[model samples]
Target: MSLLDASMNAIHLGFAGLWVGSVVFLTVAVLPLARDGAFDAAPLETVTSRLQWISRISALALFASGGHLAGTRYTVDSLTGSAPGYLVLTMLALWFLLALLVELGSKRLVGGFADRKVRQPAREARPYFLAASLVGVLLFLDAGLLSVPTAIPF
Candidate 1:
């Protein structure tokens, strides 16, 4: 790989890790606390805001780096015709789903926070976050599969 390709791959992986980690953290940690009324509205709001920012920034970074890597590494025919290409497409789909789920969950939390309702918002947002977490995990697994060499040539 060229240095530029390697750098883009690193950036892509880093942002993917960040995005997935943040979603998992929110789902596993923050949501439960918020649901239990452990956090006040202001703190919940701040947390949600930060989560949204992370999601948005990560989305953009992943898209840019992923696009570059894809463009350099695969042609339209290769992308459509190979197992690794399908995995890439799957990752792309998972990325979109993750982004959508996070956005929906954040909106729910923000809306509830606006009304000074922390627990309710957390409750409402829980399903979306849970789904996002699952998608994130799947995305990582797909990436790992893509990275491994097949015993038989494709």
Candidate 2:
């Protein structure tokens, strides 16, 4: 790989790490505290708002660098016709789903809090948090697979 490719890979991984790390932290740490009323909603809402911005930027980075990496490494045939291709395709779809979930979910949650000045019920927030965690897990697994030099048949 060229220096540019290496740089792009680094950027892509960095963004993925940030996005996944934040989601994991929110799901594993913050959400439970908020659910139990141990944490205040106002501050969490502010943090989520800022996190949404990071999510957006990282999503863009993922898209750009992932596209570059895919283009350089695989043709349409190989990308579609192989095991690694299928995994990559799944990862791409999950990435988009994650972006939508994080962006839209944060907006809805924050907006609800803003309008009512109250914390969202744990039951309501559970589904969103679970979805995010699932997406993060799958994305991380796919990334791990891709990182294996011998995993791709090419």
Candidate 3:
């Protein structure tokens, strides 16, 4: 690979790792701690907001780098017809789902806090967070798949 290709791949994978790690951390650590009352509403809100911000920025980076990688690696027909291409398409779908879940969940969580004068309960937030985190995990797995050679030659 050219230096430019290597750089783009690094950026893409870095952002992807950041996105996945943040989601996993929030879902596994933050939520459970908040649920157990280790973190009060105010601090939990701040942490959640910050995590959301990081997720947003990381997602943007991923999109940009992913686009560059896609352009370098794929043609339209090959992407649709090949195993690697299909994995890429699946990753794109997972990326979209992750974005949607994060956006809507953040809005709803923030709105509930505003309306109720308190953070949304962890139980209420759990499903959304879990779903988003699950998507992140799927993305990570898809990326791993992309790194390995497929049985079917493309």
- Candidate that would win on lDDT: 1
* Tens-digit lDDT track of model 1 for 60-130: 99999999998998999888998888888888889999999999999999997667899999999999999
Candidate 1 ranges with C-alpha deviation above 4 Å: 151-154
lDDT by residue (tens digit), candidate 3, 99-136 = 78877666655655544433346667778889999999
Better of 1 and 3 by TM-score: 1
As a whole number from 0 to 100, the lDDT of residue 42 in candidate 3 is 73
lDDT of 2 by residue, 63-138 (tens): 9999999999999998899878888899999998998778766765676574543256433665776798799899
Clash pairs (backbone) in predicted model 2: none
Total colliding residue pairs, candidate 1: 0
| TM values, all candidates | 0.95, 0.88, 0.88
> What are the root-mean-square deviations of the candidates from the true structure over C-alphas?
1.7, 2.3, 2.3
Candidate 2 residue-pair clash tally = 0
The residue-level lDDT of candidate 3 at 151 comes to: 46
The lDDT values for all models are 0.90, 0.80, 0.78
Q: Rank the candidates by lDDT, best first.
A: 1, 2, 3
Compute the lDDT of residue 124 as modeled in candidate 1: 97
